[model samples]
Target: MRTLLIKNAKNIITMDKDRNAYPGGSLYAVDQQIVAIGNDIPYQAADTVIDATGKIVYPGLINTHHHLYQNLTRNIPFVQKTELFDWLITLYDIWRCLRPEDIYLSAKVGLGELLKSGCTTAADHFYCFPNGVSGELIDEEIRAAGELGIRFFPTRGSMSLGRSKGGLPPDEVCQTEGAIMRDSRRLIETYHDPGRFAMVRVGVAPCSPFSITADLLRESASLARSYGVRMHTHLAETKDEDAYCLERLGMRPLEFMEANGWVGPDVWYAHGIYFDDGEIGRLAHRGCGVAHCPCSNMKMGSGVMPIVKMLQAGVSVGLGVDGSASNDGSNMLGEVRAAHLLHNLMHGTTDIGAEDCLRVATMRSAKVLGWADDIGSLEIGKAADLFMIDSRQLAFAGALHNDATLPVLAGLSQTVDTTIVSGKVVVKEGRLVGVDEEKLARMAQAASNRLLNEASLRTKIDYGRMRANRAYPNF
Candidate 1:
């Protein structure tokens, strides 16, 4: 039985029931679970000791939504300024060129970025499968996460509606609904684990409303429930999606999802920007969760989510970095900062603050993913999943004026210096310990170029048509 001890931190934001902050506190872990947390614990010999005198410790950030594959296609020139539907349409051809190696390389690059930014738990929505790519794509991501030693929740995302069937994606990229369900079941049976300190888990994600059939949604939810895994999907991200569901399905997006068994405690939706008060109440009542992606929503002109309203109504909300292609970066710290700014902007200065944003990124995010009992907070008997930020940095030079209460405030004032997951140090001194960042960057760039140059995809992309087709299709 291995043990690790973290001693003499500047502060430890426990994020417990009382939201306590322990100054000059120490925590001890045996195996992968935290055994004790307080000012000073009785000495027991340990294999590892992290002296974090100048650092602040908190629960590792949890990312509730992301398209890790999209890291390969970030900041493409043509689609940089487009809205949600237009952006997806313009890049659909590019995403079709994603090979298994591309997925692996991008997952490494993206996960490395998240780890550097203090994110230890991440959920990746990898829906695109082209050229007969199997669930091996998800296996590659899981392999990367295991090598990095971070906790991962990879959703088996599927798209079953093509442009020929009035969907957003082309026929080559979309699969049959029956095949999607079968593969989803296969992925859950093979990957999902409910145990504490689990390294990898699976989620059922049926892409988005416009790219998948209603039948797929219902069936996927039923299958996920049968396997006791969680369900995720994109919902009401933009006004266009709102109009589409209202006109086509004779109900708003949330109402349509309810008709198809998509609402519950086990399901969470990404970029819930256009949900109304009634819909928010429905979500809160049913224990449904939302993965709030503030930067992506603002970048894509999807409007601000009523996050404050949702929280006030008792909805479970978490922070998401969304897709790197849309947000153009995978910095989880930046997502927390954006969440702070956007939520305050939407509700007013008094409603949402830095602590609220931090909670959304850590404990609240764990709740959204249904992993709160095991990994969200720094509690005895919980998994030792947390990160440290050096408060000595320039960002917090004058910010630690209130020494005892400073670390909680410094959460918004500094970047992560160390990221620990399951009692293992995955990042130390602000660098990834498990992989070479420079090499991963080079491989990611090469893969991005190859995706852009793929013949079948390059021939299908019509940049001129994308620019000319400005007519918003009637919902």
Candidate 2:
């Protein structure tokens, strides 16, 4: 069938078993799987040939967690300084006004941004569903990702505990457990492709411990396991969440999750910032994974995760941009850089280096999502999912000693020159190949404006012009 070749790369940072790097490298692929990769690749010509002479190539970054719809709700003035509980409380009112068009357009904007930043695979956690809105909102997201050509893993996220039932979300956004379970199964049967080099996969994600009931958590895990898919949720994200679990369930957040069968390699939690040393050890022992969202945690005033300790204890820790609302953007490269800098500040400069951050974004992230066999590295028979950066750019002028580290340690210019997914170049010359970005931006802005105005008018809460004057402004 179709074949692709990348030739004369400045350096190919292959995160293989040996963590090899080849200068003046080349890679060849047939159909979607890589056939050869090294300094001396055998057959030369292909249908598509990318001359990567001045560029450094690396395994495409994988995003383990995100809330793509929240791209429309970023930078709201009132919720800028709030912590997890208050932040979710304020945003739930606005998120309850989400429309199907909003979901599609925002997924385009968020997923498009991730593609530009060299993210080839993305796992999005879209959990909010207003009572009267379409229950199949994840379909819109799946459609958007297909159009963009980014390998998508969209979790059927649900929230069953409304404020009326002692949950964080408003009553309007919660749903019945029966409805959530039925939709999740339908999505898996319709779209989940477990075969190698899969372009689309599905996961079961209940919103969070505070936003969903324990019964739903157990049921969601059981449902996902029955279908042999992964499970995701937010856990141990803040001190307030710990307090809530201790008071409401008489257990810590991790302990409660364990009691509900939510711990294992097939499951991953977002923003694991509040786990103790003992809890981190438990996660390691149980083979659980953590999606560490450094940017979102910092933006929400959530404390830093004990990532260094987790890694030392052999826990699978991956980096994610979290949600567009909290991260303010889906820039996976920036997330990698932030992870490197933040950990160095917390631990030492040597504890988590630039290449280590890249590994976390690539290989470790794939492991977190249970996709290590098919993705996460540039190896023979693996999917040729990778990105290229022009290492000769002015920002990387003198930092060419280590091409693997250039992405994390170098100054700006993090936007990639090209991004390939499944042996197809989805982004070329720093632009999306399948999208007209200007049109997408216009439609997204219109959808976002309609959503915010509708929510504001319905609730009489001024989201656009609200002032952040007090130390803690009341929503």
Q: Which candidate is the best by lDDT?
A: 2
- The collision pairs in model 1 are none
Model 2 over residues 1-475: C-alpha lDDT tens digits?
Answer: 8999999999999998789988998999999999999978787899999999899899999999999999999888877777778778888888988989899999999999999998999999988989789888999999999999999999999989888989888889889999999999999999999999899999999988888998999999899999899999999988888998999999998998999999998989998888988999999999999999999988878889988899999999998999888999999999999998898999998788888889999999999999999999999989999999998788888877877888877855655999999999999989999688999899988887887898789889888778556675775
Report the lDDT tens digits of candidate 1 across residue range 4-64: 8999998899878789888889999998999999897895468999888987898888999
Cα lDDT computed for each candidate against the true fold: 0.85, 0.90
How much lDDT does candidate 2 score?
A: 0.90
Evaluated at residue 368, the lDDT of candidate 1 is: 99
Give candidate 1's TM-score.
Answer: 0.94
- Model 2 earns a TM-score of 0.98
Model 2 alpha-carbon drift over 4 Å, by segment: 472-475
